[model samples]
Target: MILDAKQNEKPAKLTIKFNTDKGTIYLEVPCDIPDYGLQESIEKIIEAKCILDNNSNEGLNDLYIVEDKSGNLSIMTLTEYINYRKSIRQDILLLFNHD
Candidate 1:
């Protein structure tokens, strides 16, 4: 069912998947982010993951990005993510120059 949130409200179940060294990991991302904002959202998630896992997402280029349309899933590339970041006025260099 389509549950519409109030204006400026956010979803509560935003999630993404990633293939890690050991296995697949499902991450809970924050809601209220537009499609174009996914790039930064994912970076934030990965940054948190890096802190928790004590490793960088250096080679993890592909992301199982969940779109805003009816929970549809898509495997987004780094280029696509950067483009999306550009659309949302986020820093694109973070995708590559992360420490």
Candidate 2:
């Protein structure tokens, strides 16, 4: 979140990134909307962008959503995030394994 010149004005944004055969695309979306609304907005944006550029969504295998948490940045697709969580859980289980 970036603070405006005026006091108490914190602005937040969601960064979306995707890779195409030619290059990578980056988009910034306002984060003031609700979670569901934000999801829909992102989906529509991606769909429209791809369509306008004559690209197929099915061919986009490197789509990702960027997130900033506590000054740290994380860039990963939904599948990657799920797999990361699973790996973390597996590590914990391995640490506590007995017998």
Candidate 3:
């Protein structure tokens, strides 16, 4: 999973994405103000969602939540999730182009 943030005139846009064997999941969030407070809140919300969905006991650090399992698994916020999905799509396109 990955999380990315962009700043615009109107609001701050955040996207989250994850890759799974089934496919991908994404989430996007737009905030009126791009402040640390808002960012922290958003991160917490995303962490909670990830915990609930994955049924894992983990904690959030920086922009992502670390899975305590013995795997390179990471969860992202909703917004980050969306951006990650987009990134994956772009990678697929690049791969096909090279082929």
lDDT of 1 by residue, 1-99 (tens): 225443443347666676655334454445665785676566655654454355355655344343433443333545665575465454435643685
Off by over 4 Å in 3: 1-71
Using TM-score as the measure, the top candidate is: 2
Candidate with the larger lDDT of 1 and 2: 2
lDDT of candidates 1 onward, in order: 0.51, 0.55, 0.49
Model 2, 2-98: lDDT tens per residue? 7755554556877666565534545445667668756665675566356436644554444344433333224344476567557767875787695
Candidate closest to the true structure, highest lDDT? 2
TM-score of each: 0.30, 0.36, 0.31
The stretch of ten residues in a row with the least summed lDDT in candidate 3 is 60-69
Candidates ranked by lDDT: 2, 1, 3
- Evaluated at residue 92, the lDDT of candidate 1 is 34
